[model samples]
Target: MSKPLEQNFVELLEQHQNIVHKVCRLYTNNYDAHNDLFQEITIQLWKAFPKFRGDSKFSTWMYRVGLNTAITLYRKSKRTINTQQFDTVQFKISAEEYDSTEEDQLKLLYNAVHQLNDIEKALVFLYLEDKNYKEISETMGITEVNARVKMNRVKTKLRTILNP
Candidate 1:
């Protein structure tokens, strides 16, 4: 890659790296898996960057690429699941951000989210990020109605998981 293009890529990636982190956290079970998925997502984003037309916001494009990489390229072995304690998992949230009760609730929510299938997790991630149905459909390559339906189902599933 040319220096200017490389520089631009670095700048954009630095600016929107949180999107990658969010996807990685949702997709992976532990710290090592999170780091691996983050690297893989970054590589995929770099490879796809040249083809990124300036049509959508860079963050929007990043979400599409990052989510696709998480769903398709970074598959985990179903037989060898490694669970980590919620406290050990480092996400964007910090210890001081919430009170103990809120922290416990957040942990429960993340645990419930981790139980969802890949597609369902992606839908929940986008929904939590405030992506509209159109943006969710564009990112996931599903119809808007399908996205809505899936999101509703995911919410119902989450409620059940939390309540149970």
Candidate 2:
């Protein structure tokens, strides 16, 4: 007797669902949009799981599918994102833990990240995840050299955005 493949998929997805959440967070600003994108990414992962061979890690495959789904939907969806100050809905904090300076800086950084194009944002997200150039190239379907070049450019862009 063997455990079913669907069960295995469920278990693996449960273990790695945080990756999907991170993707959703990077790609979507609003809570509603985050949940929506999360659901879509999970569905895409489940649909593609059957074809998954163990050549690479499950988490690696999830990154590719998650990023592709997010990038594709992000490009197709035409919607306006309203920027707001003190967006309690998006950044909830308890009264005790509230620090205006830290919160403001975090908000500023997020705004800077949101300014980047989809591919650049993806590159930044992968880099933050501590992925190497080779891993990023594999996840992004680009050569390692390309990933390194894009990452350096993105870093410079982020510095300019943050400082200026």
**CA lDDT, every prediction?**
0.86, 0.84
What digit string (tens of lDDT, one per residue) describes model 2 on residues 25-114?
788767788899999998898888888998788988999999999999977886544543435444334655857887788788778888
Off by over 4 Å in 2: 1-3, 80-105
Residue-level error in angstroms, candidate 2, position 72:
0.5
Q: Lowest summed-lDDT stretch of 10 residues in model 1? A: 74-83
TM-score of each: 0.91, 0.85
lDDT of 1 by residue, 26-135 (tens): 87777777899899999999999999998888888899999988888545454323444677766565768778898788788888888888889899999899999999
Name the lDDT of candidate 2.
Answer: 0.84
Clashing pairs in 1: none
* Clashing residue pair totals per candidate (backbone < 3 A): 0, 0
Point out where model 1 deviates above 4 Å.
74-83, 91-94
TM-score of 2: 0.85
